[model samples]
Target: MPTSICKACARLMKEKEDFPRGNFDSDYCASCVDHKGNLKPRDIIRVNMIRYRVNNTGVSEEEAAEIVDNLMRSLPAWNKPKTPTT
Candidate 1:
């Protein structure tokens, strides 16, 4: 079986259900994309991740925020350099 990591949430995608719209070519997971297969805003994903961690892992909100921040920074989607607007 092939596996891929979601660029937005770091979710391990081992099955078709794990990918957004069940598309294996997608770099993000279902949780990270909208129904149209567009990636959600970074802040939205960040908040969702933090909430998930706090609820599932029994972690403090602050701790989850910190952990998510570090994790997002290491992810390809969030780690890329930002471009300046013209």
Candidate 2:
């Protein structure tokens, strides 16, 4: 097999390397990977947003709400939860 190169920066891609590792490879170099690992924060948020939308596909509102609830439950205490009142 031919050594697949990064389309972005034209560098050789090694096994278990690079980010956004799905169908499309990046143009970043190995040095760039070292300098700036995987996805940026904004990019990560964007990807998560895309994933969230994709996961919502065919899911009901109640199911989506439950998913959000579960995610909230798993978060750290820095995030405050709403308390129930009498």
- The 0-to-1 C-alpha lDDT of every candidate, in the order given, reads 0.89, 0.41
TM-score of each: 0.88, 0.26
Model 2's TM-score against the true structure = 0.26
Off by over 4 Å in 1: 82-86
For residues 19-74, could you state the per-residue lDDT of candidate 1 as single tens digits? 87679889899899999999999999999999999999999999999999999988
* Per-candidate RMSD, Å: 5.0, 13.8
Best by TM-score: 1
lDDT winner: 1
Window of ten residues with lowest summed lDDT in model 2 = 77-86
In model 2, the clashing pairs are: 8-27, 9-27
Span of ten consecutive residues with least summed lDDT in model 1: 77-86
